[model samples]
Target: MLAALPVAVLLFDDEGLAYANPEARRVVELDATAASSPPHVEAPAVVDAVNRARRTGQAIDCELERDGRQWQVSASPTACGQVGVVITDLTEVRRTDTIRRDFVLNASHELKTPVASIQALADSLRLATERDPARAASMLESLEREAARMSQLVRDLLDLVRLEERTGEEEPAEADLAELVRTQTTRVAQAAAEQGMDLRVDVPDVARVAGSPGDVRIVVANLVDNAVAYNRHGGTVTARVRRAGDEVVLEVSDTGIGISPEDQQRVFERFYRVDPHRSRRAGGTGLGLALVRHAVRRLSGELQLDSTLGQGTTLTVRLPPAPTSVAAPAQPPPP
Candidate 1:
């Protein structure tokens, strides 16, 4: 790949810049006569890596700073008494990795609580058999409740994992978007009814998308379910589907306490909730938006949200249109 041009490069020795590739000079923020200048440390991790690569012949690889943005830095010893450094923008990868790691750890920690509680209660019940049947029954009831909580947690974990895997498969299909929204709206209507909330649907007759029906249903259900579950005591949940040019848009809007601007970015994170106490009381897994994001990415679509604190939130999903060619029928052989 010598033919493949890079974005930036830098050469440093003795903790000072020696030479730099044109792209590297512009990107790494180096000026004229930088060879005599110091190599600025953007991150401690990267500085450590550089020190390690200097002490040893190993390469230093880490995220560094350039123009206040994160970039991947790779430093290695060169043949001519110089250190070769390569910088690549890794903001997206770093962000995705951070979210993924948080998801795994949070899911484990959340699921472990109920399981550990149940285990403790069971042990107590076993040892307290001769103490009092009433107390033993109470422990048994707590155990059952924790057991159910554990079951729900486990189900949500599995659902998150399944969605995580399937949503990256890039499977696309032709289907009616309006019908999918209507179906999901009908399904969640009963759940909304439990809270005495009104659920309505406004679907265009022929909105279509180029995505798997199962995945589309998932996106619809999660959005609608969140709207209903997080809504006020007597709120309204609306599911609307339409098309704008070549994009099919599905929106789920609710009259609930909306999200704040600061927390809006974190809402799509797995196991993240603006109000943890209320989320737990409402029995949410906090993986809804995360799943929706993955589904949208796999479907080659875009998912956007608009919300105002104390007003409401709207989730808008736009899916690309499917191609309109049917497979040719099998032709009979001519005798």
Candidate 2:
């Protein structure tokens, strides 16, 4: 019965190591020859736990790290003067806890900045309304900007959460990649113009992909938005879409202050900013790339980034092409 247990289990008698289940043998690399040896030789931490349980006449639960993995060791004193030890792997659980803690901390820090600004601005606006009407008008604008920033932040957070929670159980409908690129690019063209950046789009008449339209929109909009937001004055931002064999490819390139080699590795991390001051000034929530990454993954796509410091940057995404059977019929020639 003990041998059938899934978790690693070891039985130690007064003499020495008495029995070890298959799991225990596999986990600790124990063999028949080692059965007669003391348990400490195999796992010192397990031995210590067993000793503590035997001494106290109760079960002892402890966590330990071994071979770069987290493990939970539970030792119980059997009724017949033997000790039973169970070892369970906890690496994934511990990793998840760490990620959760970090996310909460980062989110709180991101939110606190805007909340504090709004409070301060409100107070100043009140004072200026009575003393200086002109200044009060400017304060009102600033207040509105801050409020909008906070609103955008909240919406992005919700979108990211939704994308992460998706289980890929629902079948995705076909989306027009070319149309998505054109619409997203057009939406950001005014912003590009205001910055004196030339915007361009190159796409086939019909490029279709199998994915959620919302997910694809997020991916396209964020890419275009980032290109416009981080570009240099009079620079060029180009978006291109093409069908490559089994994949639909979208590429957004920008002539901006490119990312350094070191920063490229973490560009997709939530709330991470390569240039925090510039990001805030551009009304960015620092979640654009993170959202793009998640949305692309949800569509079973690949994202690539190439940047040269002081030169330029380009981002590429490849998604599964929609099956020919479901491809949108080519539109009738402009009547």
Candidate 3:
């Protein structure tokens, strides 16, 4: 029945309102008895759409905001000199569209920076080749760096898309948390050493988790890389994994520049940098923390950050432990 339909529907003719479903009445907050007379709805946008449909003998659609809600109002003319109106709630859909638009704009802006730098450097190099050999070599180095940065950015964006697609739909397998942490720490230890920072890693002897090994490896690598990359020279970077009751915890701490309370809240956002220039100088793509956060989420994990702006920052991650049948008894890893 039209009256029982979920969508708001109204039928009107040259005389007045011929019929209005219950939903239509509720949407515009009109009384059922008012159906005999044309409602005095003062929304010019919807009214104009209906009038346009009647005058042109064609369908018209418009979106409008009223009473703190967004709506899509459509008017379709009928053969018998009548118009049928349909209103759909567009609040959530519009919000999603806005977010998507913003993301694309931000990503474009981010991509543009390195590309512009590369182009400028290339032009300079071309001119320097005929004028100054030293200048040309310097320009070539700069161009290489910009190209690498752009490559990293594209890779991280793709990784983010894949991770987002897997959120809440992960298929986990039995993985050794201890081995993952230990191996990742080894991979980044050289970088930390080169920066004159200490890399200390501690893992349990045989802590097992249920997660995609590749995804979990990525999470460990990103966090450790961020710790070393953001840390100050002669500082300390520590990574550890331990069992906390039913949960497994992975923590990465850095004795480098800490994040302010304000920036801490947004650190997980894609392409967010506390110090854009400094992060860029450190060869960071600004997507590391975002990737880490999303990957952890896919594994059903919680991440926490603790920091004092001038002291250091620590990121703590907790994940649901593998089933008892899969996990081995926990013990501290070798020193």
The candidate maximizing TM-score is: 2
**Stretches of candidate 3 above 4 Å error?**
1-7, 13-44, 67-69, 80-82, 115-144, 166-172, 194-196, 232-234, 306-308, 325-335
**lDDT tens digits, residues 125-183, model 1?**
98888777679988988888888867867766676677667634454477777777777
- Global lDDT of model 1: 0.76
Whole-model lDDT, candidate 3? 0.84
Candidate 3's displacement at residue 171, Å, is: 5.6
Candidate 1 runs further than 4 Å off: 1-19, 31-66, 69-97, 120-172, 204-208, 322-335
Show the colliding residue pairs in model 3.
Answer: none
lDDT by residue (124-179, candidate 2, tens digit) is 98888889888987888888998999999999999999999988488759788888
lDDT of 3 at 188: 83
| TM-score winner between candidates 2 and 3 | 2
Model 3 lDDT per residue over 248-308, tens place: 8889999989999999989998778998988888778888999999888888889899998
TM per candidate comes to 0.69, 0.89, 0.76
- Which window of 10 residues has the lowest lDDT sum in candidate 3? 325-334
